[model samples]
Target: MSELTCFKAYDIRGKLGTELDTSIAYRIGCAYAQVINPTKVVVGEDVRATSNEIKNAFAQGLMDMGVDVLDIGLCGTEEIYFATKFLGISGGAMITASHNPIDYNGLKLVREDSKPVSNDTGLLDIKLSAEKNDFTFADVKGTMSVVDTTKEYIEHLIGYVAIDTLKPMRIVVNGGNGAAAPTLDRLEVAFKQKNIPIEFIKMNHEPDSTFPNGIPNPLLHEQQAVTGDQVKAHKADLGIAWDGDFDRCFLWDSDGRFIEGYYIVGLLAEAFLLKNPGASIIHDPRLLWNTIDIVEQNGGKAIQSQTGHAYIKEIMRKEDAVYGGEMSAHHYFKDFAYCDSGMIPWLLVVDLLSRRSTDLQTLVSKRMTAYPSPGEINRKVADADVAIVAVRAKFEADSIAIDTTDGVSLSFEQWRFNLRKSNTEPVVRLNLETRGDAVLMQAKTDEILAILDAHA
Candidate 1:
């Protein structure tokens, strides 16, 4: 069997025409049918230009294998997860490359009950089968049906926040000209039907496959001003933006200042603890002092896992976590089949505003001061392993404790940092945080960068 470069550690993603095309997509669909062997599978596509053709070819492959296809047209990734469980389907696949460049595309696959299909969980098998391309068509071809799960998804999201607890507030929403607008529009209608007094001022709300306003990748922090300026201009209480598929969201405070995803993890952890005391909360190893403090003070438990969706979701299932937040802006919920949702986080955050009657900055500023972090910084090196080893050697002598759970995390009396290599690149990521010391955090961050530079 030949190797497929499109198959990645978590999902199938690659450049559009070269690494992934209609032919490869067909093979992948047939392979998925062969490996998963599901009778009925749910399929959906984002707003990418190539998504429709690729999804159709994929559906044909499933049909040839006698697996019925239920198509949910034009949706975000979480919709696939929701439909997979909501419709009682055997499996589901979403055609999206969430936050990837304009010319890239890929698929996020999940099996029954919305469990992820990653490297160890049947993705590699699917990749190998696709490479072989030896599957046969069944005697009776499967049929295709278009389904609507919007109402069900909206109702489920509404279940997370109480309407009476909501206060009159204005919010700025930037759809990133991707797939988030449709869902947001529907949610506005639902909120109106329920008489919720929240006003939504939308930016880049229209869906455009060309991505005229650039891709909706709020995590990159490049377009933070686009949403932040609007929030301040409109005098809105909060600002929210989503990536292409609306799976991960980024936040901004009232003064239009960007709030790092690291702090959002802590904020969300505290929110979950306030409602469900002593609930297990899952967090990534990077930039987690704030999260730990919040969980502990609020009478909850904090569990750290590797920094990836598959890793976090597996731990969510194992621990039955009430909520899980990553520094990369991914938030997972037990109520949503342990899947991450971009929409749920904002709803809960706004609900927090209503309950506390305070602004976003006021809520996060104290935690931001108590445990200052510069967020994750990436450094490209000739050899990532050498760089990591070099840094560990320099810090281990003075470190009070060290952790290699996912990476080398060295803790001092006042400051701590986690240095880990990237899965898809020859780069090392540094996440450093200090206990109520922003100046020391910056100094340590600069020191680590200098060491990484020397090693490079």
Candidate 2:
């Protein structure tokens, strides 16, 4: 048995040909089937060049294990989640690296009802089983079928907003040459069918596995300028972009100013809370004041969970939270089987914009002013834990409140910051926010960086 290093905390991802290949994917499928023993499993693939081959191999392995396969070809990760719950399948897997470099490919798995299969849940065992390369074949192989889930998924997304209530608006949508293009096409047709007036200025709207523009990661500052520039060039009311698998969405205002994901969480929370007052909202601990403020002000309960989709979804299910959002732009909803969707967040925001009769900038500018955050900053360090501990020791004395819910979050009277190590990389992430004071935020950010730099 060969070693397998592709499995990670939340999903399986690795460089193609080296750490992951068709054979490895097949082994993973077999291991998943044997471990979970699902009767039927749904499979989907992104627009990556190797995705089809990998998907087919994985399905073959599942079928050999006597597990029926439902292949929903050329879709996003959220679509697989939607199909898994909507079709009542036992399990599902999405073949995607999700904004990783073109040389990479991977899988995101889920159990019944779109419940995530993270390391803590069952991914580690599956990894070990695959490494063992031990499989007992069943006498009868299960059947395979193809199903197109686009229409139903689009309809489900449209339900989040009222078509008639949306005012005529021009928007720029940069699909980043990933899985979002096809879905955007379906959305256009749906809008036309409902007679909703929306002009979509498409940029990088085609799915090209080569990624001519770059990987579709909007979190990178370099990848964001294109969307912002397109929004300005088209004079669109707002700009929206998605990562490779379209599970996360980023936004830019009318003036081509990129809005941080932290603020979007607050905006979306306010939107959901208005619809379902007193509902619970789950938020990540990295950046809290803004989300807590918005949720509480809107008569909603704000619950803090660790920073990850699995954690947020579990907390959402436990609390029956109406919505859960991470500052990284992943938004989960109760109606979507407690899964995250890239399409729904923008639609809800558009509805809010139309109802308010204001541009995206106007809607979020005051909130940004009230709670200024420098966004999340990452530093590559030799030892992330050492750096985190040093920063904690430096700030522990002055902090009015300290919480280790996810990492080291220390709160002061006028400002606060969270310093935590990355789950998948050798880096420390720092997030700072202050009370309506950009200067203070900057100063505190610099102070924290100096501490980090000294240790680095």
TM-score of each predicted structure versus truth: 0.98, 0.99
Per-residue alpha-carbon lDDT of model 1 for 3-79, expressed as tens digits? 88999989999998889999999999999999999999999999999999989999899999999999999999999
Where is model 2 more than 4 Å wrong at Cα?
Answer: none
lDDT of 2: 0.93
**lDDT tens digits, residues 106-161, model 2?**
99999999999998899999999999989987899989999988889999999988
Cα RMSD to native, each candidate? 1.0, 0.9
TM-score of 2: 0.99
Instruction: Give the Cα error of residue 126 in candidate 1, in Å.
Output: 0.4
Count of clashing residue pairs in every prediction:
0, 0
